[model samples]
Target: MPKRKADSVLEGVPKLPRDSSIAHHTQADYIEVNSFVTATPCDHCLDSGVPCMIDRSRRYSKCASCTRASRVCKREFYTGREWDLLRRAEDKLSSDIEKNEDELDLLEPELSALQSRLTELY
Candidate 1:
């Protein structure tokens, strides 16, 4: 049997293209794969006592360590000074909503009283 030549070129790197002798691996590919990994657990996971090591694949799963509906990793969106600003905005909106609800609650009886008075006047 004649000796095959392709085997010798692919001997070192298994995934390298068989047609071409060049390998196309890049540092970015390794970094992208490791993007979901964290040296420490996310704060939500840690605070909840689960200390979740969130993987990108598992972020959308029901068993994710964080309770947030957002699929985005908290580190990506809710980190640094931007996170602090988001928290402040959330708190303000919550306060405003509660205040409006309370005002509506207070208006209900008054509206009923005015309706009853109008019924009597009519």
Candidate 2:
């Protein structure tokens, strides 16, 4: 028995012509897969009392540590200045709420009196 030529074995296969249009495409033609990742670790790491060593190459919201721990990853972390501002805002809101509660307490009796008067009028 004689060995078959490689060309004869591939003779049954249909060949497609090289696409010149594909060669014309540049890098810009392809969609970028990697997203912009932040260097900072997620809130879970901070809350867990662990160092936030984020692996930016993964391009995931959760860091590798957090992912392994099966925890939710939150990116929001306040700086010292932001925390101070937030505390001030919270104090103001609490004062406003107390004032509103006092005003509501004062108005409750007056409202009851008005409702009683309306009932008598009707």
Candidate 3:
């Protein structure tokens, strides 16, 4: 029969203090929640023909329309599968660079030898 306070709903919840008023709903709280709800999708998701919608509850950033793993979302906004893909891509790029460097090293010697032969012939 009595009117319950807005903060009464948060009773027993850890981190948040009890006796806090609904009026205590700060601008920061709204901003934080809004950020969780709205985030930019990653480039992969954009390119994959999937709309990158932010899922606050998703362990991985998944497509809101297809529920598929989204590569366009950031780790903060979306975790799990898509995050793994981003990491793997980074690793592959590093490996490719190393391979290119190795090839260049091999070519350097042959290039020097060719130059030396041309000089001798001249």
Candidate 4:
């Protein structure tokens, strides 16, 4: 087949730099969600450096120190296989977190009972 002419490129859309660490301007919500990976703390505890604590008995902000609330952690292109693996890992982590939350909910009443029993004993 003969070679075809290239189509027009987008204007003013600068190429992405190889530096993943470059800071870019974005709106408030977007900026809050994405930053240099090392600089962002657990979106959950807001720099507590601890994974967020979840109690079934308590209300949780969507910002729970869970991976779902965390950063995407990638800036460059990827192979299809690599992307599949990354997505699977992310999904597994998300499920694990949900499972932990469910377990906490299931145990809340038992914890309450134990606290009451201790009070009575004291």
Instruction: Using TM-score, give the best candidate's number.
Output: 2
TM-score of 1: 0.39
Compose the digit string of candidate 4's lDDT tens values, residues 20-90.
32322122234335422322334435545553333233332222334233443222235578789999999
RMSD of each: 11.6, 12.1, 12.2, 18.6
Query: Best-fitting candidate, measured by lDDT?
Result: 2
Q: Per-residue lDDT tens digits of candidate 2, residues 92-119?
A: 9999999999999999999999999999
Least well predicted 10-residue stretch by lDDT in candidate 1: 19-28
Q: How accurate locally, in lDDT, is each candidate?
A: 0.54, 0.60, 0.54, 0.49
Badly placed stretches (over 4 Å) of model 4 are: 1-77
Model 1 clash pairs are none
Candidate 4 residue 79 Cα shift, in angstroms, is 1.3
lDDT of 1 by residue, 24-49 (tens): 12322333353354545555655566
lDDT of 4: 0.49
Ordered list by lDDT, greatest first:
2, 3, 1, 4
How would you encode candidate 3's per-residue C-alpha lDDT over 1-122 as one tens digit per residue?
32678567766767643334332334224333433433445555455654445445443333443233212333244567778998999999999999999999999999999999999999
Q: Count of backbone clashes for each model?
A: 0, 0, 3, 0
Model 2 residue 63 distance off true place after TM-score fit, in angstroms: 5.2
TM-score of each: 0.39, 0.46, 0.38, 0.38
TM-score of 2: 0.46
